[model samples]
Structure formats: structure tokens, C-alpha cells
Target: MYRIGEFSKICRVPVSALRYYSDLGLLPPESIDPESGYRYYSAGQLPRLNRILALKDLGLSLEEISAILDEDLPAGELRGMLRLKRAEIGQRVSEEQARLARVENRLRMIESEDRMPDQEIVLKELEDVPVVSIREVLSNPQDVGMLIADGYSALMPAGIMPIGACFSIYHDPEFDPTALDVEIAYPVAETVTDVPDTPGGRSFERRVVRGGRAAVTIHQGPYDMIDQVYTRIGKWISDHELQIAGEPQEAYLTAPDDPGGPVTEIRFPVA
Candidate 1:
């Protein structure tokens, strides 16, 4: 048996924490002297203390940890809870990484603002193109690639092949990266009827992407840096006194496996 301070040293936990746990009935000492009120913990209680510390590290609340310890929760249920916490942490890390990338990109752009080259902006009339497409609201912009890949996989089995580049139409009136309203499409020579939906539940439909006079420019780098091109286009539109008439679209010109990122043509309908 070891006194409270000695046990604290052995377990590498604070004596105050041990006392608090005892008060909460989480890790009570094995014995206590009634006259002098000294708490002693036996080596047998070490396993229980370790379990409490492990659960706390897994992000569980004190109340939740107490319930799990007191009720002797099943191992399977505890494993499931740990898995859920892991996924939550993973999602937060992904979001933070993306946010950090954006911050770094912005800083770089600001530093090079003066020496930025003028991107060529073309104004031309586009003809109507028929396509097979799926429109969905995505919670994360990163998922757009998977959605496009899934669309192609679904179409290939139906003998539908794209005659031209795959493209995406931004349907939202205002840009919202977190909840993007996008339409992924593949241009077909002719519209086919009754195409089955993707296995992921996105319904495929045949539609004509309306065309009009548009301002277009090509972006040839990471998608995260595409915003720089968009900024130039917006300035060009303003300088030319043109008003945007519809949602923008991006046509991918390179294969998905391109190591340097896809070369994309961005178009904005204008009046």
C-alpha cells in the first residue's frame, strides 16, 4: 500500500487530482485512516486509475467517464465510442488544414500582388451543349472530385460516353464553399433518356446547358489557387463594364490523374 502522495508519484498523477477523484467516487483510495485521515491506495487500484486516465484522454466528459467506469460498459460499445471520437478529430484536422492552406495562399498572393500578370480574358458566344449530369448540394468542396468520378462510373455502365470535356456549373447565387450547389456534367453528342442514378443516390438527368456571351479564362494550377484567376476575371468584367448574367462554369481540360492538377477553363455568362 502507498500513501496518497507516494501513489501520485508512482502513477505520475497529481495528489490533488487523486483527492478530487476520491471525492467524486471515481478512484477512491483502497484504505483510509479514520483518526488521522490519511488516504492510502493499493497497487490493485492502479488498473482502474489507468482506465480513468485513458478514457479522459479520449475526449469523454467526466460524467460520461464515470458512467462507463461504474456500469462496466461493454468493450464493443467503448470501441465504437472511441472510433466516433477519432472520426470527429479527423474531420476537424482536415478542415483546419484546408483553412491553413487558404491562409498561406492568400499571404503569397498578397506578396505578389504588384507583379501579377494580366491573364487573357476572351469574350465569345458559346453554343448550347447537351449533357448528362447530376446536380447536388455538397457539404465540402473537396468532395466534388469524388462526385465527378462517381458520375462517370455510373455512366460508363450505361454505355454513355462523354464526347467533350467534363465540366461543373456553380448553381448557387452566392459562393459558399461549405455548401456548394454544383452540377457535374459530361457533354454528350446527343441527350440519352432514362439514365439510372449513381449508386451514391445522385440522379442523372439530360439537359441542355444554355450558352451565351461569356468571359472565359484558363486556370492551370492547383484548384486552391484558382481563386486568383477568378479575381482577375472579376476585375476584367468590371473594367469592361459588363454585367454577369448567370452562374459560372468550369470545364476541365485535363485528365483527373494529372499530377500538376487539371487545366480548367472558367466561364462566366455576361451581358
Candidate 2:
């Protein structure tokens, strides 16, 4: 049996700190010397102390750490707690990564703005994609991509080739700029998923977007410029008082520009 002093020395923890921990019933020593009133600890307790230290390093209080150890928690509950912690950490990490990415992109934006090209652009009356769609608010990223792909897959087995390309029509920045309230759709045979014979499983009024129809030029390039076209089209709309009807839709004339360059014809429908 090692005295408190020797035990604290071996554990590289202060004697006073170990006594406090013992008083809190966090890591009680193996025994106490009755005659000297000294606390005695075993070398075997080192691992437990190490675990406490590690948990403390992870921002857990001694009380929390002790509860975790003493609770005799089921494997599933413990796994769930750990999974929640991991998800929290992952979000923090993603936020940091996004911030870094945005900073880098801002640098590029600055450089690009300095070399701004006067790429002549225009707007035209765009065609609508006929399909069945489900409007869902996207909060979970795991479901966002799957939402569109699953919608397409669900539509494809019905013998309907999407007339327009599959793109999300965001009403607002619901989640974040990176994530938003989006409408994912593909042109089908006015199909319905649940409501049989309903076009695209949902019904929206067939209305032409009223706006300042500018000289819309189509770009056979990349998706990145798709947003840029919106920006340009928006400016034209504002300058020309051509109000927009709905979220501008892009009718993909052909396959997207492979290896990343420009879109084929990003049509901005205007009034």
C-alpha cells in the first residue's frame, strides 16, 4: 500500500487534488491508514484516474465523468451519448471548415472581381419542366441529396424522362446559404406519386413568370455560373423593371459541361 504522497507522486497528480477528488467520491483510494489517518491507494487505480483526467480534458466535469463511470449504463445508451457527442463535434468541425472555405473563396472572389469580365448576358422566356415533385424543407444534409436522387429514381421507373434538368428551386435561405429551403424537381409525364394522374405527384398552377425579359444568353458551362446567371438576371430585372415570376429554372438542353467549365444553356425565364 502506498501512502497518499507516494500515490499522488506516481499518478503525477497533486495530493490535495486527489484528496478533493476522494471527498467528492470521484476516485476514492483503496483504503485508509487507521493509525496515521493517511490515505492509501493502489497502483491498480492509475487507469481509473487516467480515465478521469481524459474525460476532464474532453470538457467533462468531474461530476459528469463520475456519473458516466458509475451509472452502469447500457451499451446502446452509451453509444447514443457518444454518437451525439460525435455529431456535435462534427458540426463544429464542419463550421470551422466552412468558414475557412468561405475565406478562401472570398479571396478568389476578390481576385476575380478585380479581373471582372464583361461577359454579355441576356434573359429569355424559359420553359417549365413537367414533373411530379414533393416540396420538403431540407434541414438534414444526409436527406438533401437523397431527396432529389430518390425523387428522380421514383420518377424514372414510371417511364418519364425529365424534360428539364434536376435542380433545386430555393424560395429562401432556409437552413443557411449552403443549405436552403429548396424545391427539387424533374420533368416527368405530369406524373403523380400518391395522387394518381396528378402531374408530378403535385399540382402547381401553370403560370408564366412575368418579368423584364432581357436578352438572355445561355451558357453551356458549369453549375457554379448558374447562380451567377441569376445574379445577372436579377440586376437586369431590377434595372429594366422586369419582375420575375418564380424561382428561375434552368432547362438543361444537354449534358452538363464535363470536367467543369460552363453550362450548356442556363435559361433564365423572364416576363
By lDDT, who's the top model here?
Answer: 1
lDDT string, candidate 2, 169-240, tens digits: 556622265455666656545543332223335433222233344346566564455567667656755654
Candidate 1 per-residue lDDT, tens place, 28-126, comes to 899899999999899999999998899899888777799899988999998887888899889999879856865565567569884545567778899
Maximum-TM-score candidate: 1
True-vs-predicted CA distance for residue 11, candidate 1, Å: 99
Backbone clash pairs in model 2 (N, Cα, C under 3 Å; residues 3+ apart or in different chains), count: 22
Q: lDDT at 40 for candidate 1?
A: 89
lDDT (C-alpha, whole model) for all candidates: 0.88, 0.62
What are the RMSDs of all candidates, in order? 17.7, 17.9
